[model samples]
Target chain A: MLRINDLHASTQGKNILKGINLEIKPGEVHAIMGPNGSGKSTLSQVLAGNDAYEVQSGTVTYKDQDLLELAADERALEGIFLAFQYPVEIPGFSNEKFLRTAVNAQRRHRGEAALDAFDFSAMAKDKMALMELDPDLMSRSLNVGFSGGEKKRNECFQMAMLEPSLAILDETDSGLDIDALRIVSQGVNALRREDRSVLLITHYQRLLDYIVPDYVHVLANGRIVRSGGKELAVELEKTGYGWLEDEAKSGEVAR
Target chain B: MKTATPDKSLTYRDVFASGQAEEKSWARYAAKRESALAAVLDRGLETRGLEEWVHGKAAGLVAGDALPVRGEVAAAGSPEMARVAGSHLLVFVNGVFDPARSEIGTLPAGASVQPLSAGDEAADLGSVARDVESSFTALNSLFWRDGLQLILADGVVLEQPVELWFVNDLAGEAGLIPVRNLIQVGAGSEATIIERFVLGQAAVVEQPLTEVVCAAGSVVNHIKLVGGEAAGEHFGSTHVVQRADSTYRSWEIVTGGHLARRELHLDLTESGAKCDLNALYMGAGKQRFDLRTRVNHDAAECETRELYKGILDGEARGVFDGLILVARDSQQTSAHQTNRNLLLSDDAVANSIPRLEIYADDVKCSHGSTTGQLEDEALFYLRTRGFSPEEARTYLAWAFASEVIESIPVLELRAELSAVVTRTLDVVDDTLMGELS
Candidate 1:
């Protein structure tokens, strides 16, 4: 459902993602792992159509449409969801309101009627239950004063609410504890379907133990140096990215 | 014959001469009026060295000699008027108490709300908002014919808010109008007072003055909702005094007036008194919104918190000057003042000044002010959530105002003020894409 051909992108005139190529068919869960400054997050941001990153030379085809040509909001309406690393703390906007608007926007994009408040609240209640989030948290400001675990859960709750066709989670497991990791993984695993795709971007192999991916791709210096099964994450977890760095610098596994 | 653009100070002198009724029975305070009139005419139409007139220019208003004491106009209100409460509207038309439009019902067991001209309490009218303090109050005292007087007997709790609607309209005439209000909440009494400025008038200058005195242990909530298509200048002031253990919470939501400047003063004279003063203002087009707060902590163990936020777009300007003074003997006093502004346009100007004076050896006082534009990260966050760029900007602006309006405990009033803030944002047909509708 997604194909990237030599995705070269940069931000603020500094090149980040360079000479990257990847493909993910429907229902495939792909994990992108890399060291610091390896362009893992940049790859996800570029895929989500973030304007901060300029696509110098790349063609990202999503379900046969030019993904890079769409605006950020248009990409979102087209069922592309990017769970940010740091969700903004909007002071006065409640979570319920924001999520409801998003859900309605998605429905409108699908040529469906908007849900009334009652129906929306009912849907939100079920999602909150599944995410193990407090019902009252929806009434509070979006991510304002929320704990790290709650924030991740809220992002998952939002993902569940929107049911995006392609979900790219950028470092969703960074600040979560073991319990929160399992819960967030469960929330993600529940959304896995034959028609939906997931891209898990992380820095560690611990998250892979919970939500096992169909394939693992290690990005090094903006290019995928290795791609294998889920066992590659466990192997990298034990050996670390040290061996890959040598191969990356030596131009050996640069494919 | 109307000097709509008089150029000199002596022009208002002629206005004062023809406006006052020196021999009337309610004119017992003619001596005070005479002195105030002198102060106004001497300071008249001159803003050269006035310390408080930083971005506020009243010389044009004074030079116009526009203080003709609101004459009778037809009581037809515009469709923009959104009354927050279903309670009685003590309508003050053209700055005078309009008995015809005011629909006051039976009060609590021992409460009374009437015109300032109807009772013997006129003797103590200027006790809180003294006429000698400022030229604006002096001018209001000089021209205010009738005002509101709300008195709650000791221990009486009036749940229904008393809404004083200052409904003023001058059609196309530039006129400086004044209205006054005196509220006395007795000891242990609780009340809520909402002052609504329903606008849809042009060339209207409103100078509303309010004085509130909360007795010992009393609780009072004051909400000032200023909005709706108003033009010209508006200079309003509210002075409050709190007794021991009394609590005063005020929320000023200013969304109208071409040049609106409001000053709120808090005198915590008794120990253990607590006061919360919050304000939210929005300006679009060429509108200028100025809000000032002065808090004097005169007693020990008193607390004060002042917060004001402003949103400016187009070439609008926002000014916030807050001053907190802790008396020498008022030890253990805690006070904090904060002012924040969001400028939507590059040409929009925001001036924030915070002053703190601590004479006491042991006191906690802090002040902070910040002026900034919308954060690109925040905008991007919303846009990524499926809102268009314009919708995201408008939604963020509207959310900035939500913090102030959500504090109103009265549901209907909160909803009404929220709608007014949306109106001030100039939402598309005021529907906000049916989100807030």
Candidate 2:
């Protein structure tokens, strides 16, 4: 469902993603773990079409379409969703209105009739239940004055509403408490399907306990140093990335 | 050849005689005009070179002849209007009041709407006639053809709002139309009023002068909306006096006009009185929007708060000047004024000045003005949510402006203004203009 090749990106003339190559098929989950300032979030932003980063020499393909060629909204219409690390607080725009607009934007792109208020409300109610979100929160401005856990759950609620084919969770677990982590994981798990894929980017292995990944990769110095099964996350959590740092330095010296 | 002092020298013939109109209304208010014009000329149109009026300028008043209107005068209003039920409606067209179109039965007994031509201004206007000292006020005084006078007798509680709809149709000719209004609320009375200025297809201008007196223990709320296809140049002056223990709230919302300037003056005369002023101005193209407001607290225990927001796009220019004054005897007075402006394009310009003069040592007075571009962090966050760059910019701009727009007490009008802001931002898919019409 998603592919990246030689993804070389920079911001302000400073290279963040040196060279990245990744491929993931449908119904599979991939976890990318890295420490702070390791270009993990940059990769997610570049994929989501954030214009601040310069993609010097890279191409990202989502569901066989060149994602880089499309605008940010077009990418979302093409079923690419990026759950932000810190959700934005948009005043004067209700959460329900935002979700309805996003849903209709995708539907319009797919040549489907837009849902009216009643139909949209019905769909929202069903999804809100699945995400364990309070209905009152939908009436207030989007994410304004929302708690950290509430914001994270709201992001997952939006993902459920839009039902994007390729979802990128960037640091979604960083600010979540244990209970919120479980709820978010449950929400993500309920949305999994045969034709959908998810990329979980995180800095810890605790979230893997709830939502096990099919493949795990450790990113170091802007490149993936190792790839293994879900057990690798547990191993890294126990021993830390000391060995991976040494391996990266030795590899750089060999070159 | 005598030196003209600001208070009592100079004549209207010196400043306004265009060598065109053989009959001018400046004759009616000559005493008022001579005094106000001398003050204006001495102040010199608010230039940087002057001490006061330093922030004043003529809003694109050209040196051309005042053209005559050629379009069909808007038909008289109908008494059977159903759009807004239970509203005290006063309708006017081309600055002429249409009694047939007005539905005034909604007003409680003792409140009356009278035309200036029906009786003597001295008897009808009462104390309101003595409050005109500005040139704009004097100009309206001399040339005002008809006015809708609303007076609420003491202790009368008006349940319905008074809607004064001013419709100007310049079908073909580009002309100037001026309006004058006086509203007096009696002691312990409360009322809400709306002054709507609508321009038709022709190019024209509407300059209105208004004076409001809120008696002791009374409350008043007023709103002004300017919109339409007519290329209009609107200049308005509003002077309000709040008696002891009275409350006054005013809002000015502008959407469309060629050139518009609004001057708001508020005086707190009695102790325990409070005033709240809020305004929103949106400018596109070469349109200029200017707002000047001054609040004077003359007695103790008076409070005032003001917030003015502006959004400028294209080559538009916006000017905002707010002044708060506390007299020496007005102790325990609290006043604050904030002006925030957003520049959407490189060519858009905004000038903001917030001033405060306090003679009372124990008073709380604060003023601030800020101009800013879109927040980069907020923009990036929106973009990451799949919003286009333009959409993100529009959403952020609306969020910045929502604080002032949401303050309108009337829910329907507040929603309509929101839709206006949305269309002004060029985002969103729906509009409320059709419904308003």
Candidate 3:
């Protein structure tokens, strides 16, 4: 359902993602793990069409459509969701209002009638339960004074509300505690469907343990160096990316 | 005959001469404003200057000789207007007192509505209005023909808010109109006062004065809603005094004004008095809005809180100056002031100045101001959640205003003001595309 070919992107004239090529079918979950400055987050941002990053070369297709040509909001309406690493705190905007607007926007994009206030409220109530978020939190300003774990859960709550075709979570487990991690992962696992795809971006192997992926890709120095089954994450966690760096060097020497 | 753009000092003089009989009685205070204008002219409109004239100028207000008195008022208001309880309802047309348009229902038991023009029976209470007179107040006192005087007997509670409607429907060119209001709440009496200003005529500029007084141990809730012809220009002032244990809360919402400047002064004279002042301004299409306010904590254990927020787009300009003064003997006083603005265009400008003058050693006073554009990260977050860029911006802007809008007591008025703000921001329309976008 998603394809990236020779994707090269940069931000502020500094190259970040270089020659990235990947493909995944529906019902598949792929995990991208990398060290600091390895372009893992950059790939997620580029895929979500963050305007800050400029695509120098390459094309991305989602469900047979040119994803690169779409605007950030258009990509979202087309069922591409990116759970930001640092979710923004939008003061004065209630979570219920935000979620309703988002859900309706996606519905409208899919040629369906937008949900009324009552319908949206019912849907949000059900989804809030799924994410274990308090009703009071949904009534307050969006993430204005939310705790780190609350922010992660709110993001997942939104993911559940929008029901995106491709969900790319960028470091969703960074600041979460063990309990929050379990809850967030449970929400993600519950939302998994055969017609949808998930891309998990992380720096550790802990999140992968909760939401096991079909494949694991090691991203180092702007390129995917290795791809294997979910066990590759546990192996990398044991040996670290230093071995992958050596393999990259040896491969370069051979070239 | 049309005159050259008059100087700020001379402008006050013109307004004073053209004021009504009540306003003329306080004309002697013009010297103080004249001196202030001279200081501003000599030192210039600096950010540090707390002068009202300087702040008015920052709002792009050009004082005219007189306000055009179109003499038009709504013949009949909606049922809600009748439902609102008040000791008296004094309506004005083009700043002229219109007795015919007012409806003074059955006064609360032991309450009276004494017309200021009808030989002041309670002349002693008039001293507060006369003693604390500024140039604008003096002008309003001189011009106002008839004003509402509410007297609540000790321990009376009035549930309905007293409504004062000021209509500016000047079709022709008149300038610098002044209006006055004197409210007296008896000891341990409670009441609510709402003032509505509607500009019906379009003109090059408008300068009007407004004065108010809250008596001892009385509670007053003042809501000022401004909506007028798109080209309306307005300059007004409200002065409030809270005696021992009295509470005063004023909410000012300005949606459409070519150049609107309002000055609010809260004097906490007696111990245990409190004031809560909140304001919201929505400007677009070259509109300029300025608000200058001062909260004086003179007695011990007084509290003052203020929150002013603005949303400016197009080439609009917003200026807000809030000052908190804790007097030398005002110990244990608590004062807080905050002003925040959002600019939607690069050309839009917002100047927020929060000033605190604390003389007491044992006081907690804090002030903060912030001016910024739409948060890019928030915008991106909303977009990724499927909201169009325009819809996201509008939602955020409205959300920012909801903080202030919710404070208005009148639900219908608040909803209308919110709609006006949405229309002014061009964020929404009746069309489905507008909603979707």
Candidate 4:
């Protein structure tokens, strides 16, 4: 469903992603685990077409089309959704209004009829239930005065509503408590399908317990240094990223 | 009749000979009119030298040929009329009250609506608005031929709002239309009044003055909407006096004119009185808007709140000068004032001056002013949600102005004004003009 070949990216004259090569097939769930400032979030932003990060050299193909050529909103309309690490707080813009606008935008792009307010409300109610979000939260300004967990749940709620083909969960478990983590994980798991793909980015292995991934890749120094199964995450939690960093350096020296 | 010259000072001789030739017919308020004209002759127009008029060139603009009175009636069913339907309307064409066009027969008992020419029974003519130093108030009082007088008796409440529509159809003539309105709400009364001004496609100078007297325990809401396609000038003054335990709220929306200037003065005369003054001004092209307001807390335990916002685009200029005064012996007074402005273009200008004068040591007062452009982070967030850049800009601008728009007590009126704000912003920002469609 997605392919990345030696993705090289930078922001503000500083290189971040040195060489990222990854691939995910249909219905596959891939996880990227790394320490702080390891380009985990950068990879997600670059895929979502953030102008701040320039792709110095690389190619990203989504469903057979070049992804780097599209604008941020165009990418969103093309079924690419990024659950932000820090959800933005927009004052005076209602969550329901934002959701409907986004839903209708993608619908129009797909040559489908727009949903009226009544239909949109019904659909939003169902999705809110899936995320365990209160109905009152939808009427309030988008993310304004929302708790951290509520914001994360709102991102999950939006993913459920849009039903994107490819979803990038950028640190979706960073600020969540145990209960909120479970709810958010359940929300993501419910949306899994044969034709869809998921890219999970996280620093902790706790989220992996709820939404288990098919493969776990350890990223360090802007490169994927290790690829393993789910046991690799448990092993890293027991040990630490320090041994991995030393091993990567020793391997480079041997090379 | 002598034609007034633009360079010469606007004196009483020029106003009387040029605009007030028929003043002798208004015999009931003759002495008041004479004094008001004398005051204008002594002070002339509000000059740039005055502190209150420094940011606005009101005297220079009105110094030109004294506005000749035009009485042409606007066509029925004009688009402007349709914009303000579903209200009890009192129509005034070119400063003259037209009973035939007014729908005031359905007023509830204990309420009275009449033309100021009816008699002196309802005339507090220049009582509350006795600011002799103000040239605009003097101008209106000197030549205002006829206006509306609304009075609500004690303990009475109006279920429907009264809309005073002032339509200016000058037949393409450059003239003056001075309007005077007197509204008195008796004790324990409640009412909402709207004053709307629509100008035809002419260069008319509109000088309007409204005096509101709120009796003890009364509540009054006054809304002023001034705008239209006409390339004209407007100078309006509203004076409000609140008795003990009374409440007064005023919402002023200024959207259209070559030059628009407004002054609002509110006085909390007795204990437990309260007042709220909110305004929004939208300026585009070379249009200019100036607003000056003062709230005086005269008695103990009075409260006042003031908020004014402006959106300026193109080369438009906006000015806001507001003051809150807490006099001695008026302890426990609480006053808050804020002025916020958004400039869409580099050339657009906004000047905000907020002042507080407190003589009572035991009072709480705060004032602040902010001027800025749209935030980059907020813009990016909207774009990521699938909205085009234009839509994002429009939404943010609308949201910035909605803080004041949402405060309107009337639901339908609030919606109408919200739409107007959107359309005005659309014109200023070309990128968002047709994005909604």
Candidate 5:
């Protein structure tokens, strides 16, 4: 469903993602694990079309179309959803209202009619129930005064609401309690479809135990040096990325 | 008193003289009006050098040639007039109270509504809103032909709000209309007063003065709505005095005008008194909106809260000046003031000044002001959700001002104001798009 060819991106003349390549087929769940400052978040941001990051040289194809050519919002309308690492707190805007606007925007892009308030509320209530979020939280300002776990659950709820074909979970497991992680994983697992793809970005292997991935890629020093199955995550957790860094350095010297 | 400019003062003097000749029974009040006018003429129209007039240019607004008095126009109600449910409506045409149009229904015992020109009543008429300080207030007191007097005796709790509707249909003539309202709420009484203005497409000047006295333990909610079309100018002042253990809340919403200036002065006199002042103003085209507010905490344990928001589009200019004062004996006084503005166009201007004066050492007082364009992150967040750029901007601007608009006590009024705000955003969006094209 997605292909990255020699993805080379940087910000302010500093290269972050250097010569990275990956591919994911339909219905596949890919997990990218790395240590701190390993360019895990930068890869997600670059994919989501953040203007702060400059694409030095790369080609990202989504469903056979050049994804980098689209604007951030246009990419969203094209069913590319990025669950932000830090959900923005929009003061004075109700979560329900923001969700409805977003849902209707995608619907309009797909040539569908806008849902009325009653219909939208009914749908939102069901999604909130699935995410185990209090119905009252939807009436409050978007992410304002929300707990960290609540913000993560809200991101999951948005992913459920938008129902994007390609969902990028950017540290969605960060700052979440065990119960919230379970709820978020259950929501994501329920949303899995044959024509959909998921990209999981995390620093720990704990989230993989809930929503297990089909393939695991270890990103180190702006490049993916290791690719394995779900068991590789458990092995990496037992050992560490330190050995992989030494191996990559020696392999580069031999090349 | 000596005048700096004789010709500038004579213009107002001649207008006051003609107004006095029409109403002979106002002999006792006329002396007070003459002195107030003389004071204004001596000061020569609040210059920009004054602290209060620093952001607002009051000279050009006051120096216009006095228009001839046109006959009374019809009281044709427009769609923009806000109609409250179960309200006692009092209609005024061209600043004169219309008895036929007014509905002075069966009021509760101890509650009365009468024209100020009907009888001699010591109802604190010119006590709260002194003429010496404001030229507009002085001009209103001098030339006002008839004014409304609302009285609520002690322990009277009114369930229905009293609606004061002023409609100005000048029909292309340049004229001046002075309106005065004196409201006195007795101790332990509760009442809501709504004043709405509807100005037609004409070059007109309206000077409206409202004085409110909240007795001990009473609650008063005052709402003012101004809607102007074309080149109408409005100079409005609301002076409120709160006694011990009383509460006063005010909401001012201005949507349209060529030049609109509103002054709000609230004095918390006795202990345990509380006051809340909230306002939302929007300006488009060459419209200019100015709001000046002062809250004085006189006794111990008094509290004051204020939030003012402005949205400026086109080449509109908005000014917000808020001052909170804590007297020496007013310990434990809690006062907070915030002013926020949203500028849509590059040429649009917003000036905010929030000041605090605390003579008491033990007091909690804070003031803040922010003026900037819409947040890029917020706009992007909204856009990513599927809204167009225009839709995103409109939603954010509406949300920015909704914080103050939602403070209205009446749900119906709040909904009405929300609808008005939405329509206003649509217009602003269209105008901005037009400018871009």
Candidate 6:
């Protein structure tokens, strides 16, 4: 339900993602594994309509509409969610209020009724339980003084409440312990549906062990050099991305 | 030391001379007024400058054709009322006590709220905050027509808060309004006092002084809200004296006048006394809000915590000057001060100066200040969460401000204040404007 054709993007006059082509169909989990500086996170930010990344060329199509034409907030209302690698700390804005606002904004965009406080608390309790989060997290300021794992879990909690059609998880496991990883992965897996798709971007194959992907693509030097079903992750995991980096360098030398 | 001197000194001397003929209750303070005028003259009128007044000039006498504020009530002018249940409200108009509009309900035992005229101000008024404290305090002592005197008997625990509403409505005329209040929380007594200054229709220069005395073992909460649509300036000062084992907390929210200046001086006079001051100042439309606070720990084991925040938009200016002084021999004193500001427009100005003077060897003291716009990453994060850009900015700005008022006990007042900050950042509900408009 999403397509990126030769998507070239840059930020601060530095080209990061060059000629990236990817397509995710409904109900599919596509894991894009790449080493550092391979432009995986940049790709996710560009897709989520981060204006900081200038789309130099190419186009992105989401559910048959021009995705780049939408602003960041519009993309969010249109069911595009990007779990930030570093969740921001909004010191005095309660997590509950932020969640309710996000939920109501989406509902309003779809012509649905906004949930009142009573209704919202009930929904939040269930989501909080599903993510194994502390009940007090709802009232506390968003991500302020939260442990790294708690911040990642909060991102997952928001993902569950937003129920986005395109979920882009960008290095969400970078700072999580094993237990937090399981809970976050379980939260993501529980929300998978026939009409929803996920673009899981990570540097390591450890997260794939929890939520196995339908397709694994090895990315190097801003390009997807190889794509295969699941096993590509295990192979790359056992040997590391060193061979891929060498091959990229050799390929550049040949050019 | 450059200090602000009043403008139009001749006008003030002439007004004081003409007032000598009136046989008023306060006519007894003729000598005090004369000395206060001398103090005003001692500063030299042309000085008109102070480092503290660089950003916010102490509003001077500019009331063209200023009228005599002779405790007169003209039709009982109305202003927005913040009705918190179990509150004793004293509404004043043009420096006159409005008995018809006030609700000085049957106060609890050992509690009394009286007009300053009814009390003996000769010996009690300047006992806590002397006129020489500042030029504004001197001016207030010189011209204050009427005020409120609140006293809680020793060991009296007041169950209700006292609300002081000072409304200045000049009927579209230029004038000067002065308000002086004295609060005495008896030893071991506890009380909460909320004060608001509202202005309407005409150019006005407001000089206000509030002196608070917290006796030993007493606790006092002083929440003052200063703002009005008056088209001129505001100069006010608050002096708090805390005795042994007493606690004094001050909450100041200022958002009014063309240029409003507030100076708060706190003295922890005895061992184990504690003081906490929190302020939120918002400005817009070329308006200026100046807040200066000095906390003096005069005894051993005293503690002080202070936090002030500012939000400025348009070409408005906000200045925060906070100083914590741990006097010599005041060992074991701990003090902390923080000031943060947010500028919304390029032209908006914020000046933050935090100072700490520690003379004792065994004291802990620190001060910090920061001024910046909203974080870009924070703005982007909010937008990516489905909030419109404007909504994102408002929510961020509100969070930045509501932190200062988080300690207010009443939820409804907090909510109203949050809405006020969200709407104008000035914390004034324009819709709540009273019939005085």
For all predicted structures, in order, the TM-scores are 0.94, 0.82, 0.86, 0.88, 0.90, 0.92
- Quote the positional error of residue B314 for candidate 4 in Å: 1.9
Give the docking tier of candidate 6.
medium
Between prediction 2 and prediction 3, which has the larger TM-score?
3
- Backbone clash total, candidate 5: 0
Worst 10 residues of 3 chain A by lDDT: A246-255
Superior candidate under TM-score, 4 versus 6:
6
Candidate 2 chain B has its poorest 10 consecutive residues by lDDT at B1-10
- Across B328-377, the per-residue lDDT of candidate 2 in tens digits comes to 99999999998989899999999998889999999888989988788776
Whose DockQ is greatest here? 1
| Tens digit per residue, CA lDDT, model 4, B36-104 | 778877877647577777776673245656543633433444334643455677888777777778887
Candidate 6 error regions (>4 Å): A252-255, B1-14, B17-23, B28-31, B44-51, B61-68, B71-75, B425-437
How far out, in Å, is residue A9 in model 5? 3.0
What's candidate 1's DockQ score?
0.70
Once superposed on the true structure, which residue ranges of model 5 sit more than 4 Å away at CA? A12-14, A235-255, B1-11, B24-28, B64-82, B118-120, B171-173, B427-437
Could you give candidate 5's per-residue lDDT for residues A52-107 as a string of tens digits?
A: 78999989999888999987788889888888888888766788777877887788
Better of 2 and 6 by TM-score: 6
On a 0 to 1 DockQ scale, where is model 5? 0.44
Better candidate by TM-score, 2 or 4: 4
Sort by DockQ, best first: what order?
1, 3, 6, 4, 5, 2
**Residue B51 of model 4, lDDT score:** 79
A best-first ranking of the candidates according to their TM-score comes to 1, 6, 5, 4, 3, 2
